[model samples]
Target: MPISQAAQRLPDDAVYVRPRMAHYAAVSRQIMAALENISPSVEQASVDEAYLDVSGLERLIGPPETIGRQAKHIIKNTVGLTASAGIGPNRFIAKLASEYRKPDGLMVVHPHEVQAFLDPMPISALRGIGPRTAPALRQMGLERIVDVRQTDPALLERRLGLRLAQVILNQAHGRGSDEVQLHSVRQSISKETTFEQDIVDQARLRETLLWAAQEVGRTARREGLQGRTITLKIRLENFKTFTRQRKLPAPTDDDTVLYRQAWALYRESGLAEHPVRLLGLGLSDWQQDAPSQGDLFDTPSHPSEHAQTPQRDRRTRLFQTLDGISNKFGQNAITLGLRRKT
Candidate 1:
């Protein structure tokens, strides 16, 4: 809903303020960090929700229930907030189990109890069954998960496409992927903004790109990641979008390098001649345990190349200091000014 409509429907005592995305993002990062301590195979489904696969740690630690309790306790202690956990055979059953009890609750569904647990639930409780699909399922007398399981496969396949029908049937049987993907390198971290008005000034565009690069670099650093590719996105006033990319010699989580590379890509794209309606900056091709920037070229072929190490180290220290301040206070508490080119 639009803010205006939401305000109109609000009560007289309602006090709404603008969303603080950066603050929320910081908190989400903290929560994820706490979760990582529980299991190495943690998949972040969203900012607040995640799936942890504790497949073969029974001997090393404890059962799934104990692991779930520990996870909730760790999150509460570390992030100062309560978290819900659901332990099941697979992601689908686990998601349903998580919602079975809410507001600091833990529910564990074993393999033997999967059918008993899902049969009583509504068809809508199954993932991918939205408002439209729910109505269709209900019309077909598939009001519950058990109904879906009992319904004719050919009937469902004719109604909903073969793939979707099979998926729904599979979910009804409480079958889903047990794989919990760890941090994936294919995922890109990005920031983008659409201008209130189309901007023609090159300086303003560069400033926007720099800010976005800074944000991307900060997020990557927080996640302990570095990327070898820098991508720049530009949208002209006519709504035509263009993207340009460049690969770095080594992976980096430095805003300086990001900004320089992104800016270089933008210039090479030759789209700057048009007024820009939107600008974006992204870093991809993640390297989890990348070499430090200073050490990247440490085994320099020449003595002159070795001199760059100290400067790199100094810049790294400076950025680390900036990050510390930002984390302590706020994202905008300190920022590097982008100097205008002559």
Candidate 2:
């Protein structure tokens, strides 16, 4: 159902919140750090999902089951969150096994038990085979992974594209890459909000944009990253979504600069006339550990006075003070003013 319809049906006292993505990322980092203590070969699949290569630790850890249990124990103790772990010969079976028993459960599929564990499962259980692809497979009388393995490769290829068919076939047979990536970098950071009621006031929209920019900038600075592009996302009451972005003269991790850029994009888009249901802001085109000494002291020419050299240092110091206060207290302890008071 559309959010509007869902909203209509919800209880009057239902509560909503702007998700605290930075806090969640902090918790995820703690979880990953704890897991790394068990095995150095840990690949974070997502914020909550990860793959750990414990094959090398079987001798010391007892076996796969012992390793899985230990990993779960560490996560629960470190983060106060329950985790599901799957152990298998390869990544494919392991991923499926993880989902098989979820929310503080563990399932291990040994090398000899792989086929028996996977064959009876529905074809939809195969990764990448979602609703759209499942219907096609069911139409072909392929209801199970065993059925897909029995089906001809040529016929499956004809129904689905060659690449997808090959990938699905490989997963159906319990074959997948076992290599775990120890390090990964996030491509982007974003924050968004959905309102319980549609809003037409431009001031309200800009206020929300300011909040998003502050959070995005704070997260970027903490991670030691800057972005060359700032993106503004809008979703109207009718559910039509649109985005506009502009590249900066250089990279920045400044909240004021991010808000100014996003606001400029929003005005150019001519979207203020419509009632907005959702608003989002994002920073991307990552520059990790970008040199900033020159940017801080020598500012380039720009239409906004915020780019002037004197104000540039002032802005930097101001944000540094803000971060200090936030760290000592909390994110909401001190709020940066979005506009000069009359």
Per-candidate local distance difference test: 0.83, 0.85
**Candidate 1 CA-lDDT value:** 0.83
Q: Assess the local accuracy of residue 322 in candidate 1 as a C-alpha lDDT between 0 and 100.
A: 92
Model 2 lDDT tens row, 235-277: 9876688999888767888887888778878888988789998
* Candidate 1 local lDDT, 1-342, one digit each (tens): 743356467786655464555666678878888887877777788778888878887777798888889999988887789888899999998988888899899999999999999999988788789878988988898888999998999999999989999999999999999988886444889988777677888888888888898899898988899998888988776566788988888888888778878888888897868888779999999888786564332465666665346667787788899999988998789888886662
Model 1: residues with Cα > 4 Å off, grouped in runs = 1-8, 11-15, 191-210, 217-342
Backbone clashes, each candidate: 0, 0
After superposition, the stretches of candidate 2 with alpha carbons farther than 4 Å from their true spots are 1-23, 237-240, 291-321, 340-342
Q: Which candidate leads the pack in TM-score?
A: 2
